[model samples]
Target chain A: MATVNWRTINIDALDPDSPANFDLSTLTATVAPVSTADVQSLAGQIRQLLRGGDNEGALQGALENPPYGADERGKDVHLATVIEILQSIRQSDMSPMLGRIYKSPGGTEALDVLMKYIYKGMSQTNAASTTRNITPQATGFSQIHSRGGGEGGGQAMSVLLSWHEKVVEIAGPGCIVRVMTDRRTV
Target chain B: MGPPEVHHLFHHPIADHSFSADRQTLAVARENNVDLYQRAGGKFQLKDELTGHDKTVTGVDIAPNTGKIVTCSQDRNAYVWEPSPQGWKPTLVLLRINRAATCVRWAPSETKFAVGSGARLIPVCYFEEEDNWWVSKHLKKPIRSTITTVAWHPNSVLLAAGSTDGHARVFSSFVKGVDSRPEPSAWGERLPFNTVCGEFLNNTAGWVHSVAFSPSGNALAFAAHDSSLTVVYPSAPEQPPRAVISISTQLLPFKSLVWSSESEIIAAGFDCEAYRLQGSEQSWQLAGSLESKGRPGVQDHREESALNMFKQMDLKGKVTDDTKLKTVHQNTISTIRVFEAGAGTVRKISTSGVDGRVVIWTL
Candidate 1:
């Protein structure tokens, strides 16, 4: 056994009941502005996206597997981005109905769940492609600027959602999100 | 630094060689591949090639007594291969780890060994039941940083890992029969490094390239990207790790540091030169710097030897307290060994470095 670097972190000394120790808090996330009800609503909308009758087949194909390290920074970035896109779509006047969808709390909840599945699908797709290669890939805006200082900040989720324009399409008065898939490319 | 007669030999073309645990077998993992060689008469000669890994095998470590060789690659896996009746063949492949594995080491008892990955620290265990190697243990949480070097304490229960992130991570070694295994806690610690990594993702010290423990396991020495060697009190759980002392200046990065078999003298190495540390205060005066034209790593070629640097020399440092360092050779030093292995002697110094050669020097 190697001499433990216990001096640096007496892991045993850390009380599970205590607040997060400042000693080991690296990259702690900041508080989010979304209300608890707003969060639940976004989760609900994403849940509807997974209903057995509504594009459940495509959703099934996408949710076939779970993602690893996808939760590394939590789902905040993903959800924020989803909200940003939904908001932008409503502002364009093409999806007045979509703007109404976000006016309530349930839509935000659905957005969170939708964002999770989308991120999960993204990770799975990337993993299958690089199983034999040497390094991990970056699939979103946050990751692109993950290196370097402060190039991306504030509503990171919003920034990433706006960045991937080709993957999404907003249509008509019925506020709807169209997630395009390219299974053939994989 | 005491006065000792040191000489440097010249080498040619490509240099830098590594030896097996028994000190008899030396393998050169060179520029595109690894070349296997054996000791014939007094020099090393081409033996056979051990090929299975895709990229150059940058690091190798042999388990004591077993003669088993483990090689790490840029291909994201550490392959445990052994030299058999036919030649080198694959035994087991430990996968899913840091893409770049810079170093590997085995415990003194040979039952366990460790590998250092680019962004994480992975310790693989040899399981006889499946006869395969698995990512048996590691830091509780993924370190998410690059690991550069690893070494085992002589007693064989403690293993230390150094990374480019500037902090050193240590793990406890487990024995086969021992009931009480000294496992590292769920989390690994982040010690300070000589320089600061300017990268935006993390805030730690500059890159720590190398680390070495004292003969008695009382102290640990480390080499960093900055031209310096840091000595620290390495074992504890209740206290914070603090640097006891550091040998640094603006000249060059000290690549390696080791203790004499007796635990009294310290040998330090810069990539091209080897020096010594003497006195109770551990004043790091220059000992021998390599002048060797021979393969540089030909210096420090013993298991029990705690000499640092490749086989080369310059001049000796004049200091008191039985801690003066004398010049050993003139070529670049790639490694250093205490000729007495663990005999606890302070007389013999062996080194190897850039020359890919090994040489023994006596004080």
Candidate 2:
């Protein structure tokens, strides 16, 4: 047998950070560390709501306390961990846990409630926390490494946006595309 | 053009598939076993399963004339299944390689077949009357890495192999006493066993994912990992090729392709939809996607209500609910084969994908 030198080329290392094309600069804004104390207390309540399996209640708490502040790393960590847990709950099930909720009565209303919470929660992180933007950007798989970069407001929005993207991706493009092309509402 | 017929046979990824001559039996490589489905009431139902390999079965092909099935697996083995009254009988071919057999295909004559392997070799196998067994002759000289795909020439003597080493080569597997002397062609004139007839590499050093010979066997086309398809046309035996047309597309790399005609090639891959490429020996370009641009008539739109909004929000944490893709296949399309063919042209094509769907498209 003739000897041939073989080499393995990793497709990722050739072009790293292919998924960082999303412009997050406009999405991020600095927040003054004014409401740090209020957000921390609210996080405790959200934790209790999450433990009670009340996703809607937890979403409501997040919306009310919306954790926006500079130097509020403690609250940011708490909220991010909560979102991570919710995301896991949505993922671990065979059908999306949220999809089941959507099929249930008032599921859309609950989703809208959660959506409202997510909108506020996205703006809950500190603005000056751009230094904590150490999360590796997604390459292909929608695996978020850290809560997104934010003073406090952007991380929640990022999580919400990413969640929607993941759901759309998993559900096939039809779910959202059909919604976009529908003339019934008009 | 109604929607293509779809057979969602299994939940696992179908690595490869083949249809029997009568179009009744379908054999698919699913995990470690090859599952055969027979068409009944316009739908394929499970008929039998061939289980022998210890690892994942990578490729399967049915010889239409001989009514034989050949399968290879990651377990470094290939089995030829001959149909009998007692169902299909499996006979292990003496491949004598120590690496995973990636792909296998019976030649046009059904007398021989080629197995591409991770051992960096293409074994051209033929039956031996004296030994009463199938034995292979390894074309092991110039290949540098694992062979990903193989295609046999229409004459059944020349074999084309694509490898991870970023090269696609044409080797003469003209086994003595088995293959008669082929007429002079664009690939070569004088051919012998293991003769390297032609070798070509992609400009970007991309690993070739698939290789195909045009219906006439005068042209060769290969799809590479760089999302480009290169078509090669040779001039004469020792002369340089007349044209090497490389069309780099913006789409993902194609995993499989087949000649719709001498002038058209249909390819599909990670995009989950087939695309038509039209060309001559001088030039080639992507025509369009084989799928309809969009589904305009099938309206399943739910009335927009506060309830729907909340449901979307709760389930997907969004106000918009768009989960269904317009494409028939929801994932990567891995293989495309000619379903119905005429001389140097195909009328219908069948595609199987990672989503466990087998869709048949008409030309």
Candidate 3:
């Protein structure tokens, strides 16, 4: 007699839970397409806010209206500004900033947008690190230099992870689910 | 005002269900068959079964005046069943699509019907007198994804469809020979086949699960996966809508909804209970749940004796029996249909769920 492993069975194939059954594209809003020029101007404004030592304003500006219709390049530019603002804020001020944002109107949606950016940044950092690991023929001196760069990337990742933990705590788990299912690009 | 009538038919999910005009016969899509139940002794008893498709039947609708039954299935086929002296006869419809049909609804006039499919198009099927068979004309353009549900206007010329693309669109299904010229309304004047009348998106871009036209067919309401119900009223052709009111709810997403009147909408889904929403075109809000708070059989306190606990753990390894829900329907309500109506107001409504229970609620 043969024993069956129910855990290993593909339940989605038997049920109607397959990804092919539901198209993710249908979950996106049909907003007017955003061009690269609009994103460039928004990025310049956020950079100015950061230069004036207004990190909270810069972060809120970056999150107020994500370019849902922008191309990859436009999204990357906006994401870089958001990362800069996140890095500038001290660890002690994280909870207070999040508390204020969560209590404000439309705060839940803004936090959801921030969650999307955090996940995107983490994935990109992981991809870059994996690509560097694929080429193992580096000399000892180059390896040392790469290790230093890897430590910087690791620090950035930890900061993002901490922010993720705080956002989930403030917004509840629904924010994460909303970010995953939301089709609006950030 | 009274306890709802519940009939637990079987332990299988009912994808859709419909009642005859006389309210004596009930048709439900169960698994791969359409089961017809006759009202006997104040209860529904299985009287006949219509089985043809090899896959699960997704939708079933019985014509009120014509006494014809139309069913669609996941096998990419549809059949029209007619009663004769010998038995019910089935006629195959030429849908001409390779994907599974999701839903089917007969027009108010009973002259035609619209079928939504996974192929991302709606096929409006009508009988061809010359060919002596049912044929379909596809509504193909501008639809980006699979259509989940479709509704027909009161005039039988306009059709509303909710699609996975997060859009609830109203289209002109005016077949030249089948439909007469409709009067100019807020939708448009020159209504032709495949004319796009209006398109509205959900607030959060969630998949539109259900779409319905009001009793007068003047307003459109849709429930999306974001747990929000949106109502759209068109002001005129090629202009902005008069009002687009959205009511967000804390309940789970609604799978089906029906208008009780011009001012009230009843919706239900995974929450396992029905809700009442009321408003005009200006604004809308969640009225409350339809389930009475003081219904019988709701055990507020359970005796927690040590012997009882030990016996329960000895029998099932669980402390409490939390299987039953407080609501009438134990699982997700899959479909809701108007059971009885008079003077443009729904007097009674019927709901069916995955728990295989069909419940009738008196409004």
Candidate 4:
């Protein structure tokens, strides 16, 4: 096989080991303050909404909390939690859900909206450096700024790209391209 | 002591490779054809191309003693090439399988060979004297899924197969007129065709990628998709194996592995590095990696000037040179073979990877 830029994992399509199995309660005690179970439950709700032909609702669900830029210095914790949750969802039974969504009415449009959010979120995270400009200077006292620096933003973008790759792998190249390039509708 | 011999052949993935007895000629299955490379003073040159197969050639084996080349492909066919006064003559073997042939191995005796196929059966083929053509008998029992790899025992009768069904099974391919029944080993006493001597599974039930037999033919080792290596030593047929020890690693799944020596094994795969695993029947553990950490004296140590940084930012997105991996192979190592071995141990090993490079490493 050729060397792919990203890692390829094969979760048995039939018996998928979903990311929902991740223990968020224990992880919250040590690292991020956010509840992982909440994100897992959110992904579950988004999956259900997408399956039920409510693609807009699913997109809204992903962007509502936004997972970052809300609390002070919460960007790293939020981004890491969101990335983990999306990665786990990628391991779920995605093909069937994607297929069912595409079969529903205005499904392509819904997929396009989701793709727009993913693409935009990834770009925003990559450009996180430009978003924050509090350079660390040599001083006993640290400068406090209203805007947080791009600490975990680039990693968040990378994780978003990883999820995008998995989604493309399941949805097929043509479908992904169609959704990605559907400009006027979005 | 020194760096391995590296040859960047082509852009396509090399499915399999075989070296001639004299070590002068190399045959590599690239795409639908096999390219033959001849060694000159220091480098190998493209000599010939075997272009009979219509589909992707999956496996290639060159019998050193007989100087014969056999290739199998995804087109559900196999061909045997014999060197003649004029050129290499191709004789098509009647491998009556509908699905693609996955792997092929020449037996020790050189009288027969085995072809693993997607049809869930292995075709143990031998040349029919009366017809002057190769004929095969299918080993159809107990195979649950597509056979990924086949390793022939030194005795030639016992064939070990690793399949997608997460099982490594040893079957007897003893043909009636091919040979005379001889000694009884730990595998079995009554040798018959398709007799499964021993069947082993990966601890995590992962797909078996590669299976190999020790030089002494006493131990069997297999690598699975779970990034674990299981070594099995059989005591007798229909009985629990003497020992089945599994060593799991944190590295990516290993696509290929070879027994460098009785106590050492070299496995390489998705990690882009070949690792040394050392031990015996009782227990086994990972030794260090076979690759050097970084490119010595080849670092881009030039001071990061503003102009260079701007140039780098304009050309590629990343400021650092993350394109090149530290290892010699930039991709997964697909096949690893004992390049040179003697006294029941391998002295040198060869690895071909998706990066279109073939490397020979001294152990």
Steric clashes per prediction: 106, 34, 0, 0
- Provide TM-scores for the models: 0.50, 0.67, 0.79, 0.67
For model 4, the DockQ equals: 0.02
lDDT of 3 by residue, B75-171 (tens): 9999999999977899999999879999999999899999999988999999999999999999987787889999998989999999988889999
Q: Isolated chain A: TM-score per model?
A: 0.28, 0.34, 0.78, 0.39
Tens digit of per-residue lDDT, candidate 1, span B1-363: 333333222243122345675666766556545666676775666777667668656676655577777777776667666767876776655545646766676666667667777645565455555544444555423243577777766655666667654566555544355213433331123322111111111111446667776666656666665455566653354345433555433234555556764234444444445555543334443444434333343433324322422221213342222331223434456555554453565565666665544566555
- Most accurate candidate by lDDT: 3
The list of candidate 1 runs beyond 4 A from truth reads A1-186, B1-17, B131-135, B140-144, B173-204, B234-236, B241-243, B262-271, B279-332, B346-350
Best by TM-score: 3
Is model 1 an incorrect, acceptable, medium or high docking prediction?
A: incorrect
Best by DockQ: 3
Model 2 spans > 4 angstroms off: A1-186, B296-306
Q: Give residue B148's lDDT in candidate 1 (0 to 100).
A: 74
Candidate 4 structure quality by residue, lDDT tens digits, A1-186: 987755455443333233244342221112234455565566667777767866545544554454322343344333443344454454354455555655565454344444545665676665665547554664644434423665577556665676566556544443344433222221
Model number 1 iRMSD: 23.0
Worst 10 residues of 3 chain B by lDDT: B294-303
Q: Against the correct fold, how does model 2 do in TM-score? A: 0.67
Q: If ranked by DockQ, best first, what sequence of candidates would result?
A: 3, 4, 2, 1
| Candidate number with the higher TM-score (1 or 2) | 2
What DockQ do you compute for every candidate structure?
0.01, 0.02, 0.18, 0.02
